[model samples]
Target: MGGGRWTVVLDPHRWLELRRFRGLYESGAMSLREIAKETGLNRRTVAKYLSGRTPSAPPERAASDRPRRRVVDEVAPLIDAMLRAEILLKGAVIHERLVAEYGFTINYQRVKMYLQEARPRIAEELGISPGELAGLHRRFEVVPGAQAQVDWGDEGKILAHVGIPKVYSFHMTLSYSRDPFCCFTTSQDLATFFDCHRQAFAHFGGVPMSIVYDRTKTVVRRHVAPGEAVPLHPEAVAFAGHYDFDPDVLAAYRPTGKGRVERQVLIVRDHVLAGRAFSSIEEMNAAFTAWVPLRRAKVHGTHGEVIGLRAVRDHTALRPLPQSPYVVAQRHLRYVGKDCLVAFDANLYSVPAFRVRPRQLVEVRATKSQITLHATTPGAGGETLLAAHSRAVGRGARVVDERHWDGLPTGAGRRVTAGGDLPAPLQQRAQDSSSGSLMALLNRAAATQVEVGRRPLSVYDELTGTRPFTTHPNTKETP
Candidate 1:
């Protein structure tokens, strides 16, 4: 209302009022000046409202002519490159790489905002659908006993009070029935892993046609890139071969591939382990074993059938187990030390001295409860069992068999014998030497003997190097 033009901001309420006044003016019921006077507003403002043009509609502000600046614009190409390289790269990782490798000074929030717009566009260009990138996987069903999914659950420190540092749960679920079998173990080593598989197979009474598993080191020899042929562990291959089942190694980071067992891992924790204190892995396994009947009694949510009934079908369709289960062992090459001992698992086991030489290479085949040492070279007795010992429970223990040290010197002018006694010749020689020494001692002590009725006390005293005490006759006591 000053000399210069000023802007009039029209809120919705004020705009509605102006529209109502315009309606009245259109009807010729009120003059513009009269409406302005009644509304306590300026005449020109009311006239503008009454004009054919819609004055209630705010005037569009002219767009700014200055160029816009965005901090992320400079790094757009770098971000695109990263997205192209790894479609699932996180915005935080991109921001970190930008700051570290590309000298980007922008903060993480800005990078995250840019990713919100850029990720989908890049994914589309790369022909990856949004649903796929968002972890959408189709549900699948397998025929009874056709497949099983395996996964591991890490139960950290759950049994630490029982001296176990860590505990792991091994889960195997029949894909069709969703019947789960889980056991608790302290190790994921090759032997223990396959041993658990054996236990599961026994529990089910048969093996599936194929088993789906993650790229665990116990199953896979090493991790290969996507689409590459996965190199399986030698023991794993042998196990599968023996069981007549194929091992289906899942893609990296794809838990959905083994979703049945992955879900079973959680289900078991909720049903069996939650709020329960277990003293040992066996007790934990026993808890799962007890829960299995309850689990099988209920109708499965996905399959819509009693789990036990479905499992019956699955067990029927499975391949019959072999007469004897495959012996799963982790094999390693170790050199026998000069002491005729082979080192394994931080413990030393004796090898027969006649069977193995010092510095000889031997194959150590270890299972959960036993260690078997074998001679490696043909000249040294090809693949012969050198020694077998129970596995040491703790580290740094030396497990030796006295028979293994028979040929070695005893450092007492004799050699260790098989029966843990001196040899006949050595025994005779020892007896003769002892008898001669006793006779020479007696001959020397004869000069110190006194002529008494029996072996005199003076002779004994002189030989034993002690002074005999004497008492006076006048005293009442004798010594």
Candidate 2:
């Protein structure tokens, strides 16, 4: 502590220094400046540092001509070897090994600092700070029509009767423009999965040059050769092939690489999905469609103040969408009822009297506008024509033989007597219960009337009353 620039003072020495400084100023033997110079500090700083100080470290070491024992030469080589071998991998481990192997005792903290200064840790201490990650979405800049990013999201529904306040989401973003689109689906089943993408692209007003998607089952094979990526699922691969654009599957576990799409999902979640609800997926989609135009009109963070205009500008470069949105996901298998009616959903629609008894196996390709049925394998009797339903398909409904001559529904009692019109016994059972009763009758009612479709009431009656229903002329039910 003597004459070293102001020393760190401890306990009694600090009290002594303060006393000495006070005594000196009072006695006038030496100016504060002289005391400070002797202490090897400028006057004011010395006063600040030493005025009330007591010497702490056993006085300062006198001038040392000799070097201290070499910590580096003794330990650095072993540390280097461990690092090269990627062993003794951490500072604590290195310190422990040094002591265990060479009796080289070192402070744990000092070793930690030394390792930090000497080598880079390959593993990240922190992949991203939450604040930085939060701001990442703000960092994205996209080009128009060049790329699209996609991910699955939750659907939010208010009164879904399959029973839950459920909603499902499959969302997409334009990579170049950062424009976003999201839609709902009841299932990730192939049909709805592709339908969602179709809806998203249509909302964007164009397809992207490339579509970036995380490897959902719809798109990925789920297995791969070592060091080789898994292939896109055939259905998705086919969809992409049809569009003539690259289908970019993001690397597994690397959201950072697909940060743009990831960011867009958050955009839609915050601006669109959050706090939003719908009576059903259809209603939710209607709301989503309405919001898309507003979102499209918004200015991007890094880009100019307008949106849809640029979308239009870059849209021309995008591959044109298909004339048909179908992905050929249709399956051909006959679903027949015991009464010889075909079953789809829960409804039983009639086939011709000859065609009934056992359901015919027919391949059906369903579209928004048509259900084109084909004879995948003719019935056992070698039925000539696959039946077609006059009414739309629903569960409990049937597709009848086109040549069945429009016979009365099997359960239909006497015909309306006048063809071209239904009979009165076919009228809703006057004794119909508080709930639903029959699928055929209900489907028929639904087909005939929409808003007041007795279908729901009849279904409630059917489902609630009994596990099964009594049989009538054409249809069978539990009593």
Candidate 3:
């Protein structure tokens, strides 16, 4: 055979053969011809493999020399612009915008491939570090009782079989000790959120110096742009002020700021909820209580210390709780209906008819157990408490107090006997007054009065000695 240069491509089978041949040749147990016969390769081929230049790893396949067309090439500039504007822009969002705004017809796979190559280049141009763009963050440590992180997990449909539409898990992790407190709830309202916080503090036996949280509406009044001041909810501020703690709101789009509680959320789900069914929120909470001791006994992977023992240090360092916990209420403004009732939460709570007029605006403060209605504008008497009632458990319920309707008519004056005649008290008042009583004279005078007849204007004018107008028959006009 005429060959300038030859290469042997050793696929897996040939590589194993080469290994066997090397073993046999080194052992000196068989001749090259005999080894070739055993391997079904010619003696020269077997000897060549035994020489062992480790079958120059099958010549790396050369890349294509021809130019290849890509569907995403035309949209490269658009993708680059998006990545530049928001350095953390996701590939899926870029694909969606390309399809919707730019009428792109390429599949997502091509867009994803293009982004895999283009994202780094653009991020580098914008001076964003590769680690930052890759979501790499440095771990932080806090002193005992210095901070606590709070987050909410959507345990959707976990309790749906029991008629609850949704369920949520509130998680609090002490930053230093990795101490965890979680409670299940059916609502995420302002009142329930702080109530859970109070429960967590009670469980920990103290409150941390500060609590970290996401930009939840219950904590933040409104969302602001990055680097702008975040406005805290008035109730949240009041609650924190009462407890002598500060609220730390995490930055927008940054969950790693509170990664401790974030990881605890998953751990809790794995330990307590997986493969377990709960009929009520109370039952779910009880399960968590049972699992806490087990969790505390284990050495934390990050800190390498027993969680319960570390929590002892954490608890000792925390600030003592206030003498009395702050009261949390969800407030709303409603006008009194014509029926003397104010509607809230699909239920009606009554206001005293005398205290609140129809259509008067009032503030409704709803706590866990009671609903209190207060007049928005107190009168000169400075009376604001209109009425209070137990919160209704079911919808379309009307909770009313009978005393609130005391002044309204109840058909008592119009009551009649079985014979269709007035009752005794009304009959006595309606009977004739001829028994020499004081009412008799008034009745006699009224009976003797005569009826007055209609009179013409001329007759009245003549009686009063005044001039009367006379009309001429031909002119038919008065002068």
> How high is each candidate's TM-score?
0.58, 0.46, 0.60
Model 2, 189-295: lDDT tens digits are 56667777787767666678787777677678685655697777777777777766778876666566566666665665544444334456677667667666766
Candidate 2 ranges beyond 4 A from true positions: 1-143, 160-165, 225-234, 255-257, 280-283, 293-299, 302-306, 322-327, 332-337, 341-373, 378-385, 388-479
Clash counts for all predictions: 0, 43, 0
What is the TM-score (0 to 1) of candidate 2?
0.46
- lDDT winner between 2 and 3, please give it: 3
**Candidate 1 backbone overlaps, count:** 0
Model 3, CA-based lDDT: 0.80
lDDT of 2: 0.58
Ranking of predictions according to lDDT: 3, 1, 2
| Best prediction by lDDT | 3
- Which runs in model 1 stand beyond 4 Å of their true positions? 1-135, 379-383, 414-479
Candidate order by decreasing TM-score? 3, 1, 2
Q: State each model's CA lDDT, in order.
A: 0.79, 0.58, 0.80
